[model samples]
Target: MSLSDKIKSNPSFKKIAHWLMIPTGQHRPRLWIRMIVNPFKHKRGKNSIIRYRTRLDVFPYNHFDLGERSVIEDFSTINNGVGDVFIGDRTIIGMGNVVIGPVKIGNDVMFAQNVAVSGLNHGYKDVTTPPSVQKVETAQITIGDNVWIGANSVITAGVTLGKHVIIGGGSVVTKSIPDYSVAVGNPAKVVKKYNFETNNWEKA
Candidate 1:
């Protein structure tokens, strides 16, 4: 059996491992300790840093995958309920962010504080049915490489962001954003697009 498999089956070892990972908040634990404890319970890659108090709510633990050198800051929550989350290499999930899958985040993506990304939406089509009791609709969210999402932004279900995209702070993304665009405001609109012919970014 693999080391992870063995560790999972051994209650005593698992307890010991968890104990060593108890965060003190004064100093971060070693990389190896994080690797062993894997508090997020995801299949993590090498050199990734998950700061103190970050939570990953993937029941089976195998539903989440984080790439190499990625960082999930403190107080962030990643939920993969009934879905999967795949984060590519060198991504940074800032503090106080909440990401709900099925969501695919490509390489070198950066999200500022308080950014919310969700792949599920509550269905309210039936007015007779209470909102709380309404069925939920699920969709896949795809974020391409080298994207930067500003602080306090909300990326709703079914939204896809292409590569080299930049979202302004406080923006609400409700649609697909094309590549090399700068989007901002509620129901985010593209304000700028890269002009390859001019070798610059120009007004959209």
Candidate 2:
């Protein structure tokens, strides 16, 4: 099913979805409290689990819609402020990574360390309000099936990647990418396309 269809299936997600829903600015302390107390408050179903030392800041509880058998590793922060975020089954969110919302991650996906996925970009046009005080611009980020996001990569808002896409380490993705493509570089570009016959990445 399509992502929109899948999201629509759960009506409860619309009610209480936000990062930092409460006004508590001391994120670290609140996170520690959850860690010490109900670590599973961020988790959805019984099969989903967060590994040790995983530090997730306050996020919309319903925004992180997890399928069965998913694991978020240590030091991973999922802060959903913009919109809904959904993680598919058997996906692994690596350590020291940060994922913000309005992002949908697919099944069997793997994210290496220090990966940053953010869907809300602060508005800078208004000089009266500081960047943080200015109106927040919202966008959606979509990662397709069997995708692998490499270490230290940053995925910005309004980007949609297709199925089986591979993002190399330390790349910054500012735009959308097509399916089955191997993308790399600063402001990531498609360097090669997958060749089924040769079983490798060939020049596009």
lDDT of 2 at 32: 41
Q: Which candidate is the best by lDDT?
A: 1
Off by over 4 Å in 1: 1-41
TM-score against truth, every candidate: 0.78, 0.78
lDDT of 2 by residue, 116-147 (tens): 99998989998777998788897889999899
lDDT, residue 5, model 1: 78
lDDT of 2: 0.78
Distance from true location, Cα of 144 in model 1, Å: 0.3
| Candidate 1: tens digits of C-alpha lDDT, residues 29-107 | 4465445544556688899987879976554433688899999999998877636899999999999999988899999
> For model 1, how big is the CA root-mean-square deviation?
7.9
